[model samples]
Target: MPGIVPRGRRGPEVAGTGEDDSVWAEGQVRTITDLARLAGVSAGTVSRALAGNTLVNARTRERIQQLARSHGFQLNQMASNLRRQKTGVVGVAIPLGHDRRQQISDGFFMTLLGHLADELTQRGYDLMLRRVLPERDEDWLSRFSGSGMVDGLIVIGQSDQFERIEAAAAEYLPMVVWGNHQEGQRHCVVGTDNRLGGRLAAERLIAAGATRLAFFGDAEPMEFAARFAGACDVAARAGVSILACPTSLSVEPMTREIAHHLHSNAGGFDGIFAATDTIAVACLKALRDAGRAVPGHVRLVGFDDLPIASQTSPPLTTIRQDIAAGARALVDLLMRRLGGENTESLVMPPRLIARGTA
Candidate 1:
């Protein structure tokens, strides 16, 4: 019986039955109940301590955790899930583009994803990214948030799928979206004030004495739509005309479209407001190709203030979104819903970062 140990508690000096008996045995501490008995606490207290619940006194939680660690005891996640009826995981979903096959390769998505991973980890929740094609996956939301695999969901894009998102919300799905707020919307949303960002970009250019202006970026994405609307509003109020030049999410196509717009409207625009930094970068290239000078010939403003915005020659003047704050808001809202609390949609204000481009 070399592997066998005593069944019950033993004296301090008992051979092979003290703190040294760390390996799993038939009668050793294995369950929360067993660990609770050894730690002189209730099974409920042990559960809360293991979950990092703040209700347990700090010292008590530490002592119980230390005892569990010393005895090589780990909670069974499956059993724990069954007990709490929670998966302890958060699902993050990003909608595919209109092409249905485009991966989320944009810098904005990458930066937001990184911040989300960090915030979710710090909150003791595991992140599970669910990439879905709306065209192929009609019930993507249910499959992701209702599969008993996650406690809540965070959806990144709200393109033309707002209706489906609203439907899911009506069904009481615990989720949040990272996009613009719209009329009659019911889902919890965390996003920038895109309209304000757009308006500010237009107004700044106007104040800089640029009359003829152009707004770039496709309006298919609802967020960009809001930004475009804002820019148009400002242009209309100031008695300035804004030429709407639509561009796609992809770079090459967007560049071509921008170049076409610029070429066709040659000598028409002296300022431009791009819905995103990527679009602004493309505009820069197009303008350079057309032999137009920046700031002097065309005062440009972009949104998102991405890293490349600062690195570009005659750095991009852009609207900055508080990405870290947005991530925190999204996670906090979802967690609150998971905790049975009613949460409202949060909108972070946008700031205009003045640079050489404007």
Candidate 2:
């Protein structure tokens, strides 16, 4: 008898003959149901047989496998994942609350994202990225978590949405964040100790003979704020003055802002501690434009010893946050959370990388 056509395939169903082992035509067994009917077994049996569930009798499993191969039957991964209640995907969100203009192409973010992609791919999960604006959507975290598109979430930055993330963490278990760790926060986080990093940067500047320090970058974001606080901790103890020079993370405005700060405070500060290496690089350029020598007339330091840090004309001395290790920790914590484990926050120590600038 003619074989049955699979549902959703564009074909007419052929009447089945009374034979017990009739050959299913190509394209006829496109789905489990189609394959099961041809093999004279239930859909569950076909699924178990396809999955090599040893519970299915050996002869029946072999018969089903041969039929599936002969008819070119392929399992629907989406359907299988749905049955298992998983999407096999992880969401990577970058919330731009403090700097709405910040792009994912920013050096620091790009570097971290590349590491995250590598870590996620190695663990058999696909990455779905989204750039969110918390100002526009107060429920951004809830929406992303409830969208059911991803199995877990890895928020790249806290931005200015710490409260929102905390609220979401109360409900969502399989979420991890990369940002500063507070004394008490609800969400699971894996990140560098920004406060310590800031302290290290400031101390390095002070040891380099900088009496007055200027912090370049916005201090609103929690991570940056902690870094600023750390720097303040060191500055206050050493009796050296530190000033926050708010700079944007976006490239165009960042350059312009750094130039203005340098032009306006050329003789005011002897040391500069940029919030990030990207900002430090921009500050380096601004200093060059203003003809202020790095570590000669003014000491400069940065955070996140990214690749470009060493490649700069006068290599940047910065605090190093292990991005790759952070990525691994984020994934590991998220997987643990997925497994119903209550993982604690992981704050990795930041090491000071001494290069030419400082």
In order of listing, the candidates' clash counts read: 0, 0
- Could you tell me which residue pairs clash in candidate 2? none
Model 1 quality (TM-score): 0.81
| TM-score of each prediction | 0.81, 0.89
Report the lDDT tens digits of candidate 2 across residue range 39-79: 88899999999999999999999999999988878899788
- Ten-residue region with minimum lDDT total, candidate 1: 6-15
Count residue pairs with overlapping backbones in model 2. 0
**Winning model by TM-score:** 2
Q: In candidate 2, which residue ranges exceed 4 Å CA deviation?
A: 1-29, 37-41, 57-73
* Candidate 2: RMSD to truth: 4.2
lDDT of 1 by residue, 1-358 (tens): 7875545443453355554443444456768877887887899999999878999999999998898889888788888888779987999999885724333777888889999999999999999998888888898888887788899999997977888899999876579999998866799999999999999999999987789988888788889989999999999999999888887768667778998899999988999999889889989888988899998899999999889999999899999998989999999898889888878898889999999888
